[model samples]
Target: MPSFSGNEVTNEQIDELRDAFERYDLDSNGTLSAHEVRLALISVGYEITEAELYDLIHSVALYDLIHSVAVRDEDRLDLKKFIRMMAPRMVHVDSDQSLLRTFNMIDRDRDGYVTVQDVRAIMVVLGEVVTDDDIKDICQAVDMDGDGRISLRDFIGFMHSPI
Candidate 1:
């Protein structure tokens, strides 16, 4: 699963989130109502009911509640609040099995490590024009242990890291 930490939220990630928020802010009011939030989540592949959304907000401690009440149509989330709520959930969206599948695909030789050659070959197969330098740069970024290759652990960490 993705392993993003609270402190690891990057500018690029926040920018992407801002873009999403703008997309769902239909009224252009700089906020999302419950319905808009629901649509945004659904667009991002989360299937949530209204009650589930409210429950999740409370359980996740997304906001400071002065008092408790039933869900209301006026309930809304500003960009900052939405980001607070989404960051934690984003880390848990991918399961271990899904990560494994992606790792396996990247580890083309089944050697339990992803070398630059493997990544380059995959990129070529996918019709991506990447130079050897590009591959090296990617490997350098992903190889946490500095061993010139990405083990499953490194791959997982790379997947988990905020862009």
Candidate 2:
């Protein structure tokens, strides 16, 4: 894990931010449109009004337009610019640690493994309405070995993969 001062940012941080942005920008349009934002929020079980969606899109677009330099003819928001724009607004200073803690919390047995039930339990704790089918799908996705359990390595690898 990397550490940062209260005001300083790094290239790695920029890359992480950009990767996250691109992950949500599924259309690869270099901009998060209203439709994309709405779909993403709804997929994550968040309900947003049209007005709220517009406000969110406008805020993100303004940040990108003002901070992100035009790399090509498309004026796409690059990694560095996005990080610079978002760093000051970051609410969680210890997100990396929090992620590790979350993983540990989900590994309830402390046996260095997580199962589909573990995932379902964690989702329930997070207030996510996960179904048995959803848990099975998640297990299929993460359990690369066709085993019943997901090792810590597999779990982390799955988390790092693109959604």
Candidate 3:
């Protein structure tokens, strides 16, 4: 099971990356600089050390990757290229199926449905702290039937959607 979030990047993930880039690229420069990336990560509760931040900037090819091929003069980190470069690091697993398996494992009751309790249990396993309201909100979002529980199919479908 992949322990990291944003792994198993899909088209939706790419779209999300593009949206995030657009939101973070306040200047509409079509690129994200090291400082900009740092700010974005910080907003998401991620704290990178100075050395790690530098390494991440270089590893993502941010300095060399350009926003547009036609505009060769503008050397900046474009969202698409940044996504491609960082996709590997975002995911700890190699496939979406693995993530699904993890989700299944968390639905331990095998009742074909997951409730707030289920989410709480799962979060505990992942060493994450989640409030009951958070679990409830998640269930509400995924449980289209309004049954107060998320069916396996629905959960899987939600996971397939953008996070």
Which one is best on lDDT?
Answer: 1
> What lDDT does each candidate get?
0.67, 0.58, 0.59
Please write out the lDDT profile of model 2 over residues 39-150, one tens digit for every residue. Answer: 4343323456778767654554565567673334222334443444356534343435434555676788888888877888866754568689989997888886778888
What's the lDDT for candidate 3?
0.59
- Give the CA lDDT, 0 to 100, for residue 93 in model 1: 45
lDDT of 3 by residue, 74-147 (tens): 32467765675556654543334544564566578877777788878855654457687887886798886787
Q: Report the Cα lDDT for residue 93, model 3.
A: 33
lDDT of 1 by residue, 5-117 (tens): 45455554555456667777979998887767775665344656668988756643434444353333336777867776777665534443445766787688999999988
Candidate 1: 10-residue stretch with minimal lDDT: 65-74
The TM-score that candidate 2 achieves is 0.50
Number of clashes in model 1? 0
RMSD of 1: 11.5
